[model samples]
Target: MDATADASTRKPAAFIGRRLLSLLYDLLPVVALWFLAAVPFVLLDVAVSGDVRHNIGPFSLLQWLLWLACWIVTGLYATVSWRRGGQTLGMRPWRLRVVADDGGAPTHGALWRRYAVGMVSLLVAGVGFWWAWIDRERLTWHDRASGTRIVRMSKRN
Candidate 1:
């Protein structure tokens, strides 16, 4: 395949504004997943301790584990969606699709890297995402680091 030809036909890279909109849309599912994942952990704790604790103690191992579980579950949701169709439920509404920088389907590793860096980007108050404004290509840290990019697909007629 001619890389240049494929590049020429690919959709334009999604801008930060569009990306943010899709993220906001995605938050709904992610929050639901977190709630679903937390249920089992909380239930098990109640079974083992014979106490109906409403919340995990802060800085405790259970709390840490819960957080880790939530993170992994969220990652699975994102990476699998991107791998299957390049669009998560959130991206679909916005016509945004994640693709390899070379205009092909992104690899599993690349998708995970993208997810990981995206997590870091969030932890740092979205500095990595904001970097896109200054980037020559308007790419985020995750986009550049993972060799992936989100593109805005044109509407179908």
Candidate 2:
């Protein structure tokens, strides 16, 4: 094998820490989005039930519906960012880009797949993230499943 060619294909090293930081950064926008998404839910609740929040103990149909709405909103945010630029608001400052496993811009289906699997990854206490430490290419579960990976971006001249 050509060593230079192999080295060029090797996964870049700046991924692990930046992944966590980018998530933290992304949370700001996701939270804002959730807040915005909540408005209609709350408005509907008030219109129907005369209360802003449900009285049921945390797991009502309304609660689940609201949760699903927030989840979809979050997914939409990620999918759009990855599809359009391979970088979310959070990914920008960290100089990271999410690309297909083949190093191309992620396709629409691939981006949505990443978002769905990413939701699972988050629900599972981030076992997906820990998987990176053990993966030869340092790919997280979502990274592997979605055929996507985060890459360290280089500065322009």
Candidate 3:
């Protein structure tokens, strides 16, 4: 009997719990960023027309750009952090890690594929995100598509 190997094979439930916590942590920063971006439009309306009811067409373009930028920032954050550190800021706080199916740092290609698929999942009524809840293995569609897995990291051995 290989005791050490057996111990290492146990599932990481704590890590998953931590990962969920980290998602909440990350959400705070993302929402803050969204709010900051929205301020420009608010200010533009006040400064240009001095009327609350007035609509600024140029500001609308800026708002759209801000929205797009937010998505790009989020995707890049997830991809770069997951590939380099095995988790994002959110995942780290929760002590969750992401790895390739074979248990290694994901390649850039794999990260991008995961992000792209994740976007598609969001477009498709968020079925991909919800997949994790129903999946026996707790994997989302993007995770399966990218051959990635999210594991909970534990403090105690």
In candidate 1, the residue pairs with backbone N, CA or C atoms under 3 Å apart (3 or more residues apart, or in different chains) clash, namely none
Once fitted onto the true fold, the runs of candidate 2 whose alpha carbons sit more than 4 angstroms away are 1-13, 52-57
Q: For residue 45, what is the lDDT in candidate 3?
A: 65
Q: What are the clash counts of all predictions, listed in order?
A: 0, 0, 4
Query: Relative to the unseen true structure, what is the Cα RMSD of model 1?
Result: 2.1
lDDT of 2 by residue, 27-95 (tens): 999999999998886777778787656553376777788899999999999999888888899988888
Q: lDDT by residue for model 3 over 16-126, one digit each (tens)? A: 345456767878777776677667767876787798877656557756776687787777778878878887777765668777776667888888888889889878987
CA displacement after TM-score superposition, residue 42 of candidate 2 (Å): 0.7
Ranking the candidates on TM-score from highest down gives: 1, 2, 3
The candidate maximizing TM-score is 1
TM-scores of all predicted structures: 0.91, 0.87, 0.68
What overall lDDT goes with each candidate model?
Answer: 0.91, 0.82, 0.73
TM-score for candidate 3, residues paired by index: 0.68
Of 2 and 3, the candidate ranking higher by TM-score: 2
- For residue 135, model 2's alpha carbon misses the true position, in angstroms, by 1.2
| Model 3 pairs whose backbones collide | 15-152, 15-153, 16-152, 18-94
Q: What's the best-to-worst order under lDDT?
A: 1, 2, 3
Worst 10 residues of 2 by lDDT: 51-60
